[model samples]
Target: MNSTTAVTAASPPTRSIRWALASLSLSMLLSSLGTSIANVGLPTLAQVFDASFQQVQWVVLAYLLAITTLIVSVGRLGDLAGRRRLLLSGIGLFTVASALCGLAPSLELLIGARTLQGLGAAIMMALTLAFVGETVPKDRTGSAMGLLGTLSAIGTAMGPSLGGLLIGEFGWRGIFLITVPLGLLTLLLAQRYLPADQQQAKNTQVAFDSVGTLLLALTLAAYALAMTLGRGQFGVLNLALILLAGVGAWVFVRVEQRVTEPLVRLAMFHDRQLTTRLIMSLLVATVMMGTLVVGPFYLSQALGLGAVEAGLVLSVGPLVAALTGVPAGRIADRFGARRMTLAGLLVIALGCLLLAVLPISFGVVDYIVPMVVITLGYAVFQTANNTLVMADVQAQQRGVVSGMLNLSRNLGLITGASALGAVFAAAGMRVTFVVALALIALACRCARRH
Candidate 1:
């Protein structure tokens, strides 16, 4: 075929691209759904495994650790390889791992399977935005992102209620079992309908940076461990891990600068807009994760609500985010990302401020109102912020950028999980909200500078 004909065929058709998005969304939903399912299932898992609460916590920790460690390297791998191949392979791995997780007879085996599930999720999370953005028309980028974000929110919202029902009916393993069928369906749809890969020339030789990959993985893993263990003043072990992470990070940067094919582009760090968005992503994750951890306890303790009642109250946020995200995406496309981001931050700050001064009252509205406001603001902010992060990046680097975003999220998660326990211990639950309010306000100020 002529060069012109080849180029034309390489571009995905609109209908097929939309199908790919649908499949990708399902894939994304499967990955994200696991993130929160374990949160609700932790207690049931403990009972089933005959383990302590802390021991069973490894089920969730293992997954988060694996995803955070490999995401950056895996993103670069996707760029060099055929993303279509990697994406489909990820779905397969996740499905197989889900089965393993369900069948595992011990806590150790379940944790190991959960780790594999994280590997699968890292592959999908790294590629989702880049794959969809590359496939869709530029005019529809915002809409596609909105749709993707909506599925993610839906997955998170489904986890608690779904896990509760599944565990109650079929035991703790039921949560993992349900994903098998849904994942199989998504795999079939993706394999049949996703666009063909446009690989590099067969004669060209490209090398993967094995050393840099090792350094990066060590750096991220060490850092996550240190932060997660830093529940209070860093102990001797935590301090040592933190120092090891610092050394690994320094070496990783040095290695990336020297490698012919670096795992991450050092120059991407120089892009002001990208850097700001990545930082904010980390901050947002920390605040949101901490709020999620603390909120349910606050509701039950403060309002004397049941497990079901607290779950219902927590549902309001994801519901709002799912409802608001697509419209926010559309608005970003029309009015520009910067202005929309500023507006969203202001709204979030307002919500946070309200929560900071929340009255001790019988009204459930006190908790429900701020949760909805913050989530709506978060949806608007995310719609605009995500667009800006990708605005200055190359098509090839989009996968890596997505990984960076995900990396920040995991950092925030580990940070929130580790640090907030200390705060709650020191200042009590309502004070935790006050602290979150302060952080949100700080993030709002940072958004203004951007």
Candidate 2:
């Protein structure tokens, strides 16, 4: 291939760009689907491994923790190494992990495999946007991003139901195996149609932040481990893990201060607007992810529904988000993002309260109604909340801020699933819902700021 035809960040031929976008979108959808779909299998996993619901939740918690911790580091790695090379490696690793997960005979093995899967998912997420911008024409980049966002919505909406159906027929292993062929297809298209990253002057000169990476990873992983195990009792193991997290955080801050190129810029926190946006994102994620993890258990165990039935009921929230997201975007543009965010958080609080206070004798429809309401609130707030963050940041820091925002989101997912799982194990589902409601109300207060 001549230099003219070689895919570089600056420019590439138009003929194959469409295929590249499609492949990238598929990768994004695959990562998004990991959270939505795998959640449906929680109940089945609880039964298969003869584990408590809280224990099986490590399946989800470990995955989110791995992704959240590694995502920004991977993004930096992709730049130092080739973005295309890292993307391919991620896809390959994810494919292998999925197979391992399918064949795993024990819960511990499955959680370990899923952590590897989380790494793969993080690599894919780190580069998808950059690749899209490099490949898609700048003039039409907005349209391309919109398309990818839509795919994410559709995948989120359909994942639980599809996963439910897969598990019901083929068992939980089917959920992991289903990605194998699709992953292979995407890999082929990406290799053939995507451009290679051309070695650049900047990449050659910059040193990778290995120390910062280790410290941050330690901080996140230790904290995640502590929360996942801190359910009913204040055990020695939990306390030790928590102490490790504290030490890691302290070391991380010191390292970040000394590093030439830190993983996160502390100066960015000076932007009150940006910090608020990130907090709001975290709150929104807690609401969404908490419901997703808790909803299926309440449905399958409490309401006497099967996995397929729970999935169908759980899928409605995302479906409603998909239906309302675009309209909400338009409304945000017409009115304002703050108003939409406020309205959305209020609705979410209301939905949480409804779920927490509902009579024990409630039916399937009762569960679904609150979920749809919450989902509608999510769709309404997401665009507005994101717009506030992106609009506030300097163009130079957008990439960093965006990564932090996403990291916040993944943390929210873990918080909802793991921390709340512990609460569920000790107190019960309604109490967990009440805790989430409190978070939502606090987020609403954050939204009220400038």
Candidate 3:
């Protein structure tokens, strides 16, 4: 074809496409920012509410709980109701919740708003990448995922630093208010630029298994609460509640097996490749979250850095992960996902091992190198895992597949953080890292078999 003919044949780009992508990127940032941005405000929040350490921890915990509970359900809802429509609704709700959080006078009000904010966050988090997968061309999906991953990393890395600055200058309320204008801007863009749903909401009938959902939520709550109290001062009643939670979790799995439209498809376990990928996703996320929480504690305690400095140092992992995510995705696509995945697990193991042995005198360099290595591994692992999960599934089962994957990542992170926190409390920081390294090694072994 002639140059002129080729030019005429090529698809033209529209302003709306740019706007849609921009809006989606902002939504990702907002969702991630909400997760970590509150970290720096914990002490201030505690002071304002005259709360205990455990109570103040809820400022972060509530948000995680809400996200974990709602992500899969919201993702399924997005498939049923139209991803674009749900995306806009979620952004609006998130914005409103942010405003409420900023205005909250009491701890109860703040926690309530944060919970609502998590609901909104779940909507955006579920649909944002799914939208990209559907809207962007196949060739561009990796790039888009990479960019989204980068934005997510930046938001997380910036969280404590940004929150500290805002809290320092304007108080704890500023953390929530900072998201308002950005959320509103993203909402407006989404409304105008996001394409109409390819699938109409009215045509889809999705019957959510409310019983299964309730059981699952309780399982998570019980487990989280038990882990929280396991390391703290607790009464006999608390131990009984924890024991009850263990029983409830067993019930949850049994209930799920019998349900037609189960909360998590038990059949997914039959595919070793898919199962390994899913397990890797969960294990890596768990390690990442646990490491993120404990790293700062050690940095502050052993190194004597302030909150802001500690946050910056700890953010190196996410930053490195973000920076390398796209290239990692491209490499995964070029090479087979299995090799990339195995490599990622090995790299993560190395990072964890490094962290396990660091000396007391080590500073930022000591911290950044291992985190960057681990993050590089994470970027590769996540991209490969996502690709693997979607590879063999039928189009109709995409919702189920995605939902399970989302749930696994969140649940793993929650459980990992809680369990590791208890370990740190019991065995000291060094032992926690050692345990994390061992887990990563186990995950790597699992990945190798795939």
Best by TM-score: 1
The TM-scores of all predictions, comma-separated, are 0.93, 0.78, 0.87
Score candidate 1 by TM-score against the native. Answer: 0.93
- Clash pairs (backbone) in predicted model 1: none
Candidate 2 worst ten-residue window by lDDT: 1-10
lDDT of 3 by residue, 9-59 (tens): 544365656678889889989999999899779888888899987787777
Candidates by TM-score, descending order: 1, 3, 2
State each model's CA lDDT, in order. Answer: 0.81, 0.76, 0.78
lDDT of 1 by residue, 275-387 (tens): 87787777777777777877876788778889878878889899888888788889888888888887887777777677768786746788888878888888888878887
Q: Total backbone clashes of model 2?
A: 0
Error of 1 at 330 (Å): 1.3
Clashing pairs in 3: none
- Order by lDDT, highest first: 1, 3, 2
Name the candidate that leads on lDDT.
Answer: 1
Per-structure clash totals for the candidates? 0, 0, 0
